[model samples]
Target: MTEKQVIYLDFKASKILLDGDFNAKLSDCGLAKLGPTNGNSHVTTSIIGTYGYVAPEYVATGDLYVKSDVYSFGVCCLNY
Candidate 1:
């Protein structure tokens, strides 16, 4: 499997069901990335999703990496 797939599976397995006090608290707040990605990258597609949940850079460009998983994890954390 790819690195991204491994991360996706890891996150899915780690997720908590979203019907509790912790999710309620996160519902109102958002998280930020610690830094930007390397500028020298390439992407070749357009996809659809909520802006907050989509990694801004990855959506604009196809340049994905392990950090992209970090962005998805943050959004999933909010939902849970």
Candidate 2:
């Protein structure tokens, strides 16, 4: 993953792809955004993503950060 990538926003089992080598790649970046590269937060008025994958903090407030992706990734891991 690139440092500039803040979060997958919609991360889930369906969005992950594994190659023949078993290397995982994230896909469906339509909801991805270029956020704080320094690990800060980015606030937006609009929040968009899949349910259950979205962070609770982001759901309460429109603030998005790298941790939001972590939250979604955690959910995906639990599902797997």
lDDT of 1: 0.45
TM-score of 2: 0.83
Error of 1 at 47 (Å): 4.6
Off by over 4 Å in 2: 1-3, 37-40
Tens digits of per-residue lDDT, candidate 2, 1-80, equal 75455566888889889999999998888888767655555746487998888999999998887678889878978985
Model 2 error, position 72 (Å): 0.6
Whole-model lDDT values for every prediction: 0.45, 0.80
18-74 per-residue lDDT for model 1 (tens digits): 665545222311222222234433333344444565567767664444456577677
TM-score of 1: 0.38
